[model samples]
Every structure is written in C-alpha cells, then in structure tokens.
Target: TQLLEQSPQFLSIQEGENLTVYCNSSSVFSSLQWYRQEPGEGPVLLVTVVTGGEVKKLKRLTFQFGDARKDSSLHITAAQPGDTGLYLCAWEGYNKLIFGAGTRLAVHP
Candidate 1:
C-alpha cells in the first residue's frame, strides 16, 4: 500500500520563483525526510524533519513537518535552475528508504 502521496507531481517554473510541494499520509510517521535526485544520480538526503512542527532549512530550501507528523512540506525560495530535479518525500525504513511518487520540478533560466 502507498503510505504517502505527493501533489502536483510535475512542476515547471521560471528562475527566482518560489514554490512548495507537499507529502501527505493518513497514518502518522515517526520521522520524515526529503531527498533530491538529479539525472543519472541517486537521491541525496536534503533534510530530515524528525519532530512534529519542526522546520529545517538548507540554503534556499525549507522543510517542515506537520504538527501531527502526518504531512510535510518543502518550500524553495528563489528557486534556480540548479534546483531542477526529482523531489522525493520519504521515510527511513529498516536501513532503506521508502519514497513518495515524487515531484518533478523544472526551473527554467
């Protein structure tokens, strides 16, 4: 069963624009993580929001965990072309990672 759902599975935007993608689940999670993957590359951990209502930032990206830990959001401010990639919301599972359907973002210069 799919435990998570991501919205706007595809997004195309101009550089400098801000955007946000979401990950949601009906069941609460102990922790949630966000990963980004570029073409021909493995997904890399961006940020992990472990606590409810917790927020973490990495340069222009911001990750937030819902108070109930049932959802999460990733916001990018002034997004750049370098940010173009597949964004996956996931959770650590038995030393592996279970991912979302993923949000593919393309930022044009």
Candidate 2:
C-alpha cells in the first residue's frame, strides 16, 4: 500500500511562530500536492512540487519534495491565525489519490 504518514497530528501555536509539517512514505510518487482546508470548505491547493529536490514558496509557506519522491515537507514562517487549518498532502496524477492522515494547525493570536 502506498500510504503517506504525517507527523504531529495536531499543533497549537501562537501567532508569528514557525512550524513544519512532514509527509513520509515508503512508496515513491510521481508528484506531491499540498492543500489547506477550512471548515465546510474544500481544500485549496497550496503548492505542487513535481520534481525531486524541488522547492517552491508562496509567501511565508515553503514546500519541498524529496529527491526520492517518497517524502515532502511544508514549512510555514510567522504563522498567523489565518494559517490555522488542516494541511493535507497527497500523491497526484493517479486514478486514486493517496492522502496523508493530515496535520491540523491552530495558530492563536
């Protein structure tokens, strides 16, 4: 089974604090996608890193794909209350998606 494992099932931090979430797997994926979701809303794609050793940044958020394509990481700098949400990682371009357990972040002001 191609299962993605995420660390820190839940995190609570003060605003302006930085945090990192990780997604690891034994199986290699062609591409990895990161999404953030709020209550009652569908997940919004944060970033998609396809190439190994690729790094992409969106403002304060940075995403990295492992060279082996078996892991990914998301780092948020100076997190705010607006950044509090569920972060999910998934393998894309497959008929079925393999999603990580998810990391719930709560940033308090």
Candidate 3:
C-alpha cells in the first residue's frame, strides 16, 4: 500500500509571513502535483515537478520534488490573505492517485 503523509495539517499565519509545508512517503511516484483549493471549487493545479531536486517558483510560491520522487515541499514567501486555502499534494500513476491528508492554511490580514 502507498500512502502520503503531510505535516502540520493546519497552519495559521499573519499576512506577509513565510511558511513551508511538507509531504513525505516511502514509495516512489511517477509524478507529483500541488493544488490549491478554495471553498466549493475543485483544486487548481499550482505546479508539477517531475524531476528530483527540481524547483519551480510561481510568484511567492516555491515547490520542490524529492530526489526519490517520494516526497515534496511547498514554501510560501510573504503570504497574503488571498493565499488562505487548502493545499494538497498528490501522486499520480497508472490511473491511480494517492493524496495527502491536506493542509489548511489561514492567512490573516
């Protein structure tokens, strides 16, 4: 069985703060995707990093895939109130998906 474990299931931060969330697993995955979801809507794809040690940045958000492809991390710099939402990390392969427990971020302005 494959499972993804996420740290700090809930985070509350003041606006303009920095935070980092982590996803870890023992099994390797073909692809890892990060998504941000708002209330009553599906998760929006933030980024996908396939190569190990590869980092992708979108504005104040940065994502990294583990060298073994079994883990990933997301870092937000100077977060804003708009960043308050649920962040999820998912592993996809062979028409199957494994999702993390999900992290709920609250950015207070």
Candidate 4:
C-alpha cells in the first residue's frame, strides 16, 4: 500500500490570500489526485497529475507533481470563503487507493 503524509494539518486564512499545501510519499505512484470536500459530504476531485513534473491549473488553483513522482503540491490563489473545506491527496496502489490525513482549510471573508 502507498502511504501519504500531508503537511500543515490545518490552515486558516482571509479571503484574497494565497496558500499552498503538500502531500508526500516515499513510494512512487503512477498517478496522484487532489480533492476538496465540504462538511457532511464526499470529496470532489480537483485535479490529477500523472506525468512527473506535470502541472495543471483549475481556475485559481494549481497542482504539481514531483519530478520523482513521489510528491505533490496544491496552490490556491486569492482564496475565497467558498474555498473553505477539507483538501485531500490520494494515490492508487496495489489496486486500491490510499488517502492522506487531509488538510482542513478555513477561509474567512
């Protein structure tokens, strides 16, 4: 099974601020994904990075995968209160998916 470690377990910021979070692992993964979740709901996939060093942007959000394929990061620009939620990283391993502990974000307006 692939193991993921997420940094800065929690974060709080004002709207319009920018922030970044990270997910890392010792084992290489074929693909990595980012997700956002709201309270009492399931996580929503934001982006998936497969090629090493690949970068994908969704609106004000950006995702990058490590050249070694063992790490990833997410950056959000001009945060909004609507961005408040749980962010997670997941990877496929041994025919299953393993998730990180997750980062909880609170953006106050």
> lDDT value for candidate 4?
0.94
- On lDDT, the stronger of 2 and 3 is 2
- In every candidate, how many clashes are there? 0, 0, 0, 0
Summarize candidate 2's per-residue lDDT along 7-82 as a digit string, tens digits: 8899999999999999999988889999999978988988889999999999999999999998999999999999
Candidate 3 lDDT over residue span 8-40, tens digit each:
899999999999999899888777999899888
- lDDT for position 104 in model 4: 96
Query: Between 3 and 4, whose lDDT is larger?
Result: 4
Candidate 1 pairs with clashing backbones: none
**Model 2 off-target regions past 4 Å?**
none
TM-score of each: 0.96, 0.94, 0.94, 0.95
Instruction: lDDT for model 2, please.
Output: 0.91
lDDT string, candidate 1, 1-109, tens digits: 6788998899999999999999999989899989999999999988889999999989999999999999999999999999999999998878987899999999999
For TM-score, candidate 1 versus 3, the one ahead is 1
Which candidate leads in TM-score? 1
Error of 4 at 99 (Å): 0.2
Q: Could you tell me the TM-score of candidate 2?
A: 0.94
